[model samples]
Target: MEINIASGLLAALGHESRLAIFRLLVEAGPDGINASGIGEKMGMAPATLSFHLSHLSRVGLIEGKREHRFIHYSANFAVMDELIAFLTRNCCQGIGCLPKSFACNTPEGTSSQHGETC
Candidate 1:
């Protein structure tokens, strides 16, 4: 992921309501939850939920699909994975500076000195 994309994703997650909304969607998995369900779960007004959902969707953190009269929202896991990888990339540098456990935490079977799971 590019810096701009990462920054945008972070910015979308920066807001409290948006963060809560995103977290809820992630927990809901690929099937996602509808706008009303999200509002009910978050205790947000319909308008407020719509606004936050739009912001999250704009940043590619979430995706909305029309299912009849309701718009279902789901977490975009691919973008999320990209952001995670980008942030943790080159974490401890290639060296013998980290412990075994730390290296084990890295994703893709790679090891990081600080135990950063990419």
Candidate 2:
């Protein structure tokens, strides 16, 4: 991701409400949850949730689709991965750097005993 885009995402996540909203969506996975479900789970007002969701969607961290009468929100895993990769890309850039394999590089469909796959 470009620095400006990364910065925008970081800034959007800097807020507590936004972070919470993002996490909730992340935990919900690609299938996602609806706005009202999110508000109920987080105990937030509809207007407040709408504001937070807009910021997250603007940053490409979350995606929303209108499903019948409701809008469902899901975390954008690809963007999230890009942000993570960018942040950790130069973790050990200089001499005696850790091997590239030391960095996280999990493949899809790799099952985790914890019932989560990253």
Which is the leading candidate under TM-score? 1
Residue-by-residue lDDT tens digits, candidate 2, 33-96: 9999999999999988898998899889999999999999999999999999888777667334
Per-model TM values vs. the true structure: 0.80, 0.79
Compose the digit string of candidate 1's lDDT tens values, residues 1-118.
8898899999889999998898898899999999888989999988888888889988899999999999999999999999988977776784445556656765654564343554
For each of the candidates, the C-alpha root-mean-square deviation to the true structure, in angstroms, is 5.0, 6.2
Q: Which stretches of candidate 1 lie above 4 Å from their native place?
A: 94-118
Candidate 2: C-alpha RMSD after superposition: 6.2
